[model samples]
Target: MEMLSTISGWIWNPLAYVALGIGVLFTLLTKGVQFRRFPDMIRHLRSGGATEGGLSSLQTLALSLSSRIGVGSIAGVATAVAAGGPGALVWMVITALLGSTCAYAESVLAQVYKRREHGEDRGGMPYYIKYGLKAPWLATIVAVATLIGYGFVFPGVQANNIASSAELAFGVDGQVVGVLIAVVLGVVVLGGTRRIVKVVEAIVPFLAVGYILSALVIIGMNITKVPDAVVLIVSSATGKDQVFGGIVGYAVAWGVRRAVFASATGLGEGTFVAAAATTTHPGKQGIIQAFSIYIDILLICTASGLLLVVTGAYNVKDPAGGFLVEHVPGAVAGPNFMQEAIDSSLPGWGAVFVAIAVAMFAFTSMVFFFYVAQTNLVFLLGERRSKVLEAVVKAGAPAIAFIGSSVTADAMWAAGDIGYGILGWLNMACVLLLTPVVRKVIRDYDRQRREGLDPHFDPGPLGIKGAEYWETQKEPVKEPDRV
Candidate 1:
């Protein structure tokens, strides 16, 4: 545990600044496309239709959201508040707003550099780094890192959270919950990517909507306390609040760290799923992906933060030891904080409600995690598929999920942080190096929109090479139906 924490600290201590800088840089390079193309994001989201082998824009959104809006939204928000105070919530919102641009840049590059594999579109940081930059070695490193991170290290965190929440909600044992999660996940994962996509597309909306509505009910019930909660968040974030003024640095650090962990702006998680979409233009998919950051941090994470603050159901821990603020004296930082918040308003329901929500959210996220790992596995073995290697990932993912549920949350979280930090470092470097390519693509996309024509990608004329998939295309891919 100590070693894991040490590694995590080494990776993440400077990562927040790195992530922020890249986000700011991308925003400038793209001329703030996340904001300027806000309307187009919405229109293009509905415009993209899926071909026989690819996902529609909305389906890709759901797959990405499945990973984005998982335990991070609930349990991650609780940890941020407990460690960084309500002020952390403010920084989380800031990270998402800026990071949305990073999301746009990476997603655009992913689409531009995508390749067809096994009759399905497959691309991401690895593909772009390999094909776009012509560095197969660096791409191999990225693919291996992604496979290890998403496949083995990260799933445990989600599984740990789900098991802990379930154990708290019901008296079920962690091992039992772990086994159940592995079994359920195995059934879906064995069915491959299409099954995973269909399942996520069905459940992501319901999970998001249901969780948000519950938050609204809690907020509406405590309408009188809303202003005070908002004030606490703002003042604490700026080091103005009397109670939380001392740890303003911690607020920014934890908020940005947790927000990046939650929304995965530049980590290349969304880039993999984004590359799987069938869209007219790379920018359209990029814009849709940017909007997902809003759904994740702006709506879902905010809901979690508000639930904790308004109800005073959280305990703030001082990094130096002891409590800075302890609204719930015995409660540690986790989903229980939100569960307690819900219970404060609706008796006997918080644990059960949070348990179910976390289960579904974590489950969908685990599925997406497997897809990311599988995608990278394919990238690693280009034109050489090994059944033994495939079976290892197929079986190992669920095995880790089960093991994660039975272990301590602290260890799992530390491991997850290290994985995210490493991926961020690798993918960010690739994104920054390829900024010129992204810039040209964005300009092309913007020019077509301004000319009153739906954008179509033709990489050759733009001097963008390595987009072999788009180079052969003459017109936009046809849509199957709106979904």
Candidate 2:
């Protein structure tokens, strides 16, 4: 545990600045596409229909959101407030705003380089890194790292959160919850990508709407406290709050760290799912993905942060192993803070509500994790899919989830951070190298849109090499379906 924390500190400290810098760079290069293309994002999101080989834009978004809106939004936000104060939530918002650009760039690149595999669209960081940059060796390394991260290290974090929350809310044993999660996840994962897609699309919308509406109700009940909560967030973020001024640095660090974890912006997880969408133009999917960053960090995470601040259901721990503030005395940081916050207003309800939310959030994330790992494993195996290796992933993913549930939260989180840190560094490097290509693609997309025509991708005309899928697409692009 001590060693893992040390490594996590080393990896994440510099990564925060790097992620912020890359996001700023992408924003400038694209002339703030995330802002300029806001309307297009919504239009594209409600427009696309699923093809035989690809998911609809909305379905793809649901898949990515399944991963993005996980325990990170709830437990992660609580942890940020408990350790970094209200200021941390402020930085989280900032990170998401800037990071959305990174999300756009990477998703565009992913769509541009996607491949037709086993009768479906398949690609991500590995595909883009190899084909776009012409670096197969580096792509291979990334594939391995992705397999390890998603298959082994990350699932544990999600499962652990689910188990912990269930234990708190229902007084069920953690081990029992863990086993049930593993069993259910195994059933979904074994059914393959289409099954995962249907399940995620069904669950994500209901859970997200339910959780956000619940938060709104809680905030409405405590309407008088909203202004003070806002004030505390701003003051602490700017080092002006008397109680939290000393830990302002920690606030910035923790906020960025947790935001990256929550949004999965530069980690390249979205790229894998984004590549699977059926869209006429890659930029359409890219724009939709940038919008998802706002949904994950700005809306859901903010709900959790507000619940903590408005109800004073959190604690702040100094880096020096002492208490900065302890509103919930002896309460450790996690979903319990949010649970307690809800209970303060409606007795005996917080635990059950939060527990169900955590279970759903974490379970969906596990499903996405399995997909990503399987995608990378397919990449590693080349044209011949290995049934034996596939079986291993199908079995190992659930087994890891169960094992992770039994581990301590601190250890699971540290391991998850290490996985994220490694993937972030690799994916960012690839995205940076391919910036010129991303720029050209965005311009092509914008030109078509400005001419009042639905945009379509033709890599040959744009001088984009290695987009074999688009190069082979000789037919006219189909108009997207309206919602």
| Candidate closest to the true structure, highest lDDT | 2
C-alpha RMSD for every candidate? 1.1, 1.1
Candidate 1 similarity to native, TM-score: 0.98
Itemize residue pairs with steric clashes in candidate 1. none
In candidate 1, residue 419 scores what lDDT?
87
TM-score attained by model 2:
0.98
Model 1: residue 337 alpha-carbon error in angstroms: 0.7
Off by over 4 Å in 1: 474-476
| Model 2 per-residue lDDT tens digits across residues 1-483 | 999999999999999889989989989998999899999988887776888878899998999999999999999999889879999999999999999999999999999999999888998999999999999999999999999889887999999988888888888887898789989999999898999999999999999999999999999999999999999999999999999998998899899989999999999999999999898889888999999999999999999999889999999997898888889986658888989999999999999999999999999999999999999998898789788999988887889888988989889888999889989999998899999999998999889988988898999888999998888887855845743
Global lDDT scores for all candidate models:
0.91, 0.92
